[model samples]
Target: MSDLYLSMGRKEGAAGSLYWAIQFTNTATTACALRGYPGVSALDTSHHQIGPAATHSGSSYGTVTLAPAHSASAIARTTNGPVGGPCLRTGSYLRIYPPGSRSAALVPAPWKTCSGIFQVGPVNVDGTF
Candidate 1:
């Protein structure tokens, strides 16, 4: 995990749901493989988790082998709560645990979610999703 760089790609939305591409780039000299869904959660200003961790979505858990400088990505989806609603909260950042890794990476993601119920897809080769 130390050899991987994590970042957000772009914001996408449909209906009332929000999506973000969680990008993982191989920064090592050799290749690495990432499979399954990454662990994701929203964090507040104090770095405390807002709610339960993201649930896994989809079954496309194929191994994504990334060579140096290559990238893989996972899609995270969540729904925003009504303004001033009881379930609404603004997350200042996100805590991401790469597949098969115990270490976590943090990325800035100021977004709102209803109870932090995020759905994340498995990692796939770049441009495949």
Candidate 2:
């Protein structure tokens, strides 16, 4: 398997929800293929998993071929809430596992949720900027 690097993208606020792009870059010299939804979870500063695991939103899944230095991305959406809410859970990092891969990469992402649920979209072949 090719080595890939995961990075957190900018957060975009829309309506009463928030969306963030998750970038995946091919760091290895060879190409790699990625498909479906990635496994994502919030992690505390201590590296412990927090809240419920993220869920995939879209039904259709497709494979993306990643060439060296090329990238693919996914979007994660969560409900926006006040500073203090009944569903609040804070995490400083995100553990990401690419589709069908066992290894995980840690990406820095400061997150607060009113609901423990996170809906992740599918990976785009073009990366959709």
The candidate maximizing lDDT is 1
Show pairs that collide, candidate 2: none
State the C-alpha lDDT per candidate.
0.83, 0.80
Over the stretch 7-112, how does candidate 1's per-residue lDDT look in tens digits? 9988887776778899999999999999888999989989998877889886567888999999999988877555333564788898999999999998998856
Off by over 4 Å in 1: 80-86, 126-129
Candidate 2 lDDT tens digits, 1-129: 348889987789877778888998999988888888888888999999888778988658678998999988988777787523455568898888888888888888997665555888888865442
How many residue pairs of model 2 clash at the backbone?
0
State the weakest 10-residue window (summed lDDT) of model 2.
Answer: 80-89
Candidate 1 worst ten-residue window by lDDT = 79-88
| lDDT value, candidate 1, whole model | 0.83
Which runs in model 2 stand beyond 4 Å of their true positions?
82-85, 126-129
